[model samples]
Target: MKFAIAVFSPAHAPSSRRALLFAQAALAGGHEIVRLFFYQDGVHSASANVVAPQDELDVAGQWRSFITEHQLDAVVCIAAALRRGVLNAEEAQRYQRPAVNLPAPWELSGLGQLHEGAQSADRLMCFGGD
Candidate 1:
């Protein structure tokens, strides 16, 4: 089955890890991922500045590697990311920020991307959120 995943938690959250594992299992099962949308606190997963504690698992790093290796379509919500200070180069420059925390392999887009993903995929799996 093709799936579109929407993650709304931070990388340190358990739901974030579960989302990653689910994606991995789906791919291993020969399923396709239509897209991975990171919203709200989940935008932190796409930030290059995320540094896990020494004793903690680097879920953000794992997410980066997984998405890069799979060449998946990973998107971070623009409004959510901006609200949380997760910025790409262009956005940082546009906003006059001192640094850029978001990098390649992750695209910054509006919530419309998530809507599109859900529309295209056979299933839409959302993780985390109030």
Candidate 2:
């Protein structure tokens, strides 16, 4: 199976973790992940500024490592990321930021990427809330 998962909740949200776990399970079952699209509050997962409490590990960092290690297509909504101050190196330079440290294996893009992912994947999974 191929999956294009859209995660719209924050990293701390249980739904966000559920989405990640689902993806991991899918991959373990030998499925392909066409794309992992983060939108709305979910884009925060792609921000390097995310700081987890001392008692907990950084879920966003885990996500980054997972995606990068798997070499999967991970994308964060450009508009959402920008609004939340998540920028790539080029974006940081363009925005005149001092540094850029957005999550790895994630790219900033428009909704078209999500649409394309849906079309490319066998299933379009939405891990989001109203």
Candidate 3:
């Protein structure tokens, strides 16, 4: 089955870890992931500055690796990211920020990507959010 995942929790949240694990398991089971959309606080999962303790799982790193390894379409919501201070190179320069925390393989786009993912995929699964 084809799936589109929308994650709305912060990287430190258990829901974020569960979302990653669910994606991994789906891939392992031979399912196709059309896209992974990070919205709201979930954009933190794509931040390069995320650092977890030694005893805990590095959720952001794991997400990065998984998405890159699978060559998955991972998107971080541009508006949400900007509002939360998550910036890419172009965005950082445009906003006159000193640094860029979001990196490669994860694109920053509008909510239209999420809409497209939902419209195209067989299932649109959402994790976290109120």
lDDT of 3 by residue, 1-130 (tens): 9999999998899999999999999999999999999999999989999989999999999999999999999999999999999999999999999989998988999999999999999999999953
**Weakest 10 consecutive residues, lDDT, candidate 2?**
97-106
User: Which regions of candidate 2 deviate over 4 angstroms?
Assistant: none
Candidate 3 Cα errors over 4 Å, as ranges: none
Clashes of each: 0, 0, 0
**Clash number for candidate 1:** 0
lDDT of all predictions: 0.95, 0.87, 0.95
> Can you write out model 2's per-residue Cα lDDT over 1-130, one digit (the tens) per residue?
8999999987877788888899999999999999999999999777777889989867787788889899989989999988878889989989898877684678899999999999999999988663
TM-score of 1: 0.97
